[model samples]
Target: MQDIRCGSCSRKLGEGEFISLTIKCPRCKTMNTLRVTRSEPVCPSASPIGVSIEQTHHPVDRRQTSYG
Candidate 1:
């Protein structure tokens, strides 16, 4: 499973909630609207198969998120 964090507060996101959530940060109390995206890069090397996941958080309009 991938780990996601809050962009504003840097807190790890709750399990099973990756799309978007308008919630208050437990540590900082900052109201954050989070957008989570997961990306995997393609490596051309043929030695051994390796996997890497890139997660990015952006504060986007809530209406654009899947939650909306």
Candidate 2:
């Protein structure tokens, strides 16, 4: 679990596991944006002794296309 704080006032906003988030600060009214990629360990009991679990992350593209 991760804690999200206000950028201006350092107030505790919320907590959770998020890939991308946009939130407003209640105290300072500042806009906050966060992007994260987390890799957690897989439970050993769930998988076989020789098997392994893998996680992959990809980047997001935020581009605008114009048509003439």
Candidate 3:
């Protein structure tokens, strides 16, 4: 992973691989535009990785009654 920094303040903005992006700095409020092209491929995997999401349960309030 590579770090993206603000050009004006040099503050760390984000980190990731990107083709083209425009970001606003939170501290300096500067607009940062980026465009990148990789000379060599980074990964040799044939298929993309899958992301897993876990669901969370919230406690219900028993004191309130539903009218409908």
| TM-scores vs. true structure, each candidate | 0.36, 0.52, 0.53
Clashes of each: 0, 0, 0
lDDT of each: 0.55, 0.63, 0.63
lDDT of 3 by residue, 38-57 (tens): 34434775443542222222
Tell me the TM-score of model 3. 0.53
Native-to-model Cα distance after best TM-score fit, residue 45 in candidate 1, in Å: 32
- Model 2, position 57: C-alpha lDDT score: 26
Tens digit of per-residue lDDT, candidate 1, span 1-68: 55555667688756554565566656655566655454444554444344343344444444544663
What is the alpha-carbon lDDT of model 2 when measured against the actual structure?
0.63
TM-score of 2: 0.52
Q: Model 1 — which ten-residue stretch has the worst lDDT?
A: 48-57
The C-alpha RMSD of each candidate to the native structure, in angstroms, is 9.0, 9.6, 15.1
